[model samples]
Target: MRNATIKDVAKHSGVSLKTVSRVINREPSVRTETRERVERSIAALHYQPDPSARSLRSTHSYAIGLVYDNPNAHYVISMQEGVLAACRERGFGLQIHPCDSSAEGLAEEIIRVSRSARLAGLVLAPPMSEQPALIACLKAADIPLVRILAASEDPADGSTCVYVNDRRAAYAVTEHLIQLGHTRIAFLWGDPHHGSSSERFMGYADALKAYGVPLNRKLVLSGQYSFDDGFRRARKLLAVKEAPTAIFGSNDEIAAGVLAAARSTGLDVPWDLSIAGFEDNPFSKQAWPALTTARQSTSEIGQHAALRLMDLLRQNRDGHTDSSVANESFVPELVVRGSTAPPRSASPRAEAPAGDTDSID
Candidate 1:
């Protein structure tokens, strides 16, 4: 038996070949009634469009690019899965590119890759997404882009973006610690280059202020977003004369490090010490005592970004001036786990007495 062709589907749907082509390619111009008719006819005949042949006839590329520079392997993988899901549904290909945001000629490098691949659009992750100069360069090159950013409000930079309200989520996490009777909570900050670290810090500070808890500058330490950085900072915080009973890692990796630090120092978790983290990554669950953290859906965010980029690409291709992409934002919700509890004492106490109670003052 022979396979049904586009002409056959067009005839069955009572539409022209052009209309069938538009419906098959998912162009937004097709009328709702016509699109349904084409879809039904295609389904009835089990007709499938040849992606390779369509690409050969079209000027626009069928491949989209996902560009990121992040340290977390788990996060990157999750994001990839989301983007891949969207691309697969639309019969599009995905190209994953990891690069250093600070490297010289970064814009040129991106442009070169896009030109070489004839990319349809691009999805950018933090640090890279937040860079104004890089975004300007892309815009000048007429590249359609969607950014995943961490900020309290939209930048309104004339680009499509998916904002993650890290500040709100961080505030909630800090409030939870305070409610658990932890007055002396320490904060382990992530990389400064990423805007999320700053936003999370703002949330933590705001929460402390709202609760009338004094912000102890000594308790805040800056570091990279990695398990090793978290581990090292946790050790230092634990060794302080008046150790904090509870510690908040910028993300789950750091929180897991705090757990390790507590165990190494012979301190009982949530008894002698308590720890919390942000971003409900695998580390939060796999730890001996699961981490209390915020659930940021990285996959969902990635999927949103990719879908928005595709919309922008379609609009650009159709040469319709009206913007089809809407700005989207996500706020991670708090997930209470076993890793956090009320502090053992209301007053600062020493895990190992250094005989310096004065440091608490």
Candidate 2:
């Protein structure tokens, strides 16, 4: 038996090849009735479009590339899920490339990958997305790229971007702790390479300032966006002579570490000490007592980035004069869980309150 082709689908539906191509590509110009008829023929034949054949027929490629240098596996997976959703819907393929952003040949490596893959467009994830050198290289290569970045740091010209407002989300998390009567809150920071760390720190600082809480330099500790880093930094913080009443991890991984550190020291979470985290990743919920954190939809952000990249590719292919695509931005909401609460007492050494098991949501 022979395989069915686009020609067979077109013939079965009594339509021209161009109409079949338009319908398959989901172009909006196709009439509704004609589209339904073609779809029916396609279902009857179990026909699938060949990406290689389409690439050969068109000037542009059908593959999109996602480039990132993030350390969090959960974050990477979520972003991939979102990107795949968009790619599948648009009849496009996805190629994921993880690289070192600090390498001297980073830009050259990305350019080589883009050329080799013959990608239609690219989605850049932070901190790689924030690199000026890489952006320059992509622009010089004349490649269509959309970046996912911190909302506060997006370019002024409104270039294609899916922005995550880490600063605002961080502020909300910090304010949540403050409202719980936590005056001495500590911040566990992520790697300096990531722009999100700085944005989140600014939000934490802003919340404290707004509430007239003094910013204690000793309470801020530098760490990576990982469980091990969080655990190590939190252990040291817990050992301090005047430990903070509340701890805020730059990400959920760090917050989970904080939870473990508190447990090791026989301290009760949200009773002896309160803890919070950002990015509402799985680590937040899997903890013994769920972590109070900011809920940023990483998957949605990735999907938007992919969609924006496709839009840019379409505009370029159609020779449209628009210089840039619209930007999508989101401020993560605060999800109060069991991890944070008011200090047991005004003093840091106050013992855990008796039989206190109250949790928020």
Candidate 3:
């Protein structure tokens, strides 16, 4: 069946198109009775306003843009959902723009796109958010922007942005392993260009330093955020003379890869070795012996960023400035699951017991 449109509501309510538009925008010109009538007709017809049509009729566009360069599909999807929810709630349109942050004239390209689309503002995801040049360009063009950043603490520099405390979460994960009596812990790096990787590394390092465990350069490895990289790194780590009792992957994808590698080699997880991950993505829970990891709600973070962007747009339009809506921060929750425990060395038993030995195939 065809969906009800704004015109349908106007016709059903015996009101002019202008009146309906006023009611929809919540303008005060319409009488209370007329507004109630229009609203009732809207409910009866289930009318949904078209953002594009509304934008065409107004001087200011009601559209918002989401710009990101993330490789993780799940992360991108969650962020998109959050932004879309805020847009729907605020009666704004959303434009999702996936562009290469490293491309030449990247800032110019985004500014052009935002202007041509008549977007009220933009929500930027890292490494786009981390790029100062892009931010400078957007500000020079008088475009409003909200950023999502990864940091150990709130990096509130007078801009509206969402901060994810990857460093603190990583500290919690490392602390969990340390408390379980694992000294030889391995750290896998995600893409260094992304701020979260470095933040997580710092947290892990901080935890190790605080617990009197000497940082082992040999156990720390650098690689991109991927299951394949995790597999290769895990193989190398297992081959070493003194292997780490626990491995911390920067994200869940990498942790799942390590699990695949361990299973393929018939090693018992959490007995032969313990594994932990960040983000707590689905693969973490779905993996046999669910991965112990940290939880960060990507959806909530994205939604919060988009909502703040909309608020900024309102502030700019109304000529009233409020400093209260500044940088908001979130720390990921640490989750303990079946994939981690005290290493066999910590136990009195000389032999390690069997764990999830099922092959990845």
RMSD of each: 6.2, 6.0, 7.0
TM-scores for every candidate against the unseen true structure = 0.89, 0.89, 0.86
Please give the lDDT score at residue 253 for candidate 1: 95
lDDT of 2 by residue, 1-361 (tens): 7878999999999999999988876666899999999999998998867667788888879889999888899999999999998887666889999999999989888889999988888999999888887888888888889999886545565458888888878887887888778887999999998989988998888777776678898999998998889889889989989998899999999999999999999999989899999989999999979999999999999998998888788767767876577787899999999998778755322332343311111
| Higher-lDDT candidate of 2 and 3 | 3
lDDT digits (tens) for residues 241-290 of candidate 1: 99998999999998998899899999999888888899899999999789
Pairs that collide in candidate 1 are: none
Q: Rank the candidate models, highest TM-score first.
A: 2, 1, 3
What's the residue-level lDDT of 112 in candidate 1?
Answer: 92
lDDT, residue 219, model 1: 99
What overall lDDT goes with each candidate model?
0.88, 0.86, 0.87
Note the clash tally of each candidate: 0, 0, 0
Clashing residue pairs in candidate 3, if any?
none
Put down candidate 3 lDDT per residue, 72-171, tens digits, no spaces.
Answer: 8989999999999888766789999999988999988999999999998899999999878788889899888999999766666766789998988998
- Between 1 and 3, whose lDDT is larger? 1
Mark the regions of model 3 whose C-alpha exceeds 4 Å error after superposition: 1-45, 321-324, 347-361
The whole-model C-alpha lDDT of candidate 1 against the native structure comes to 0.88
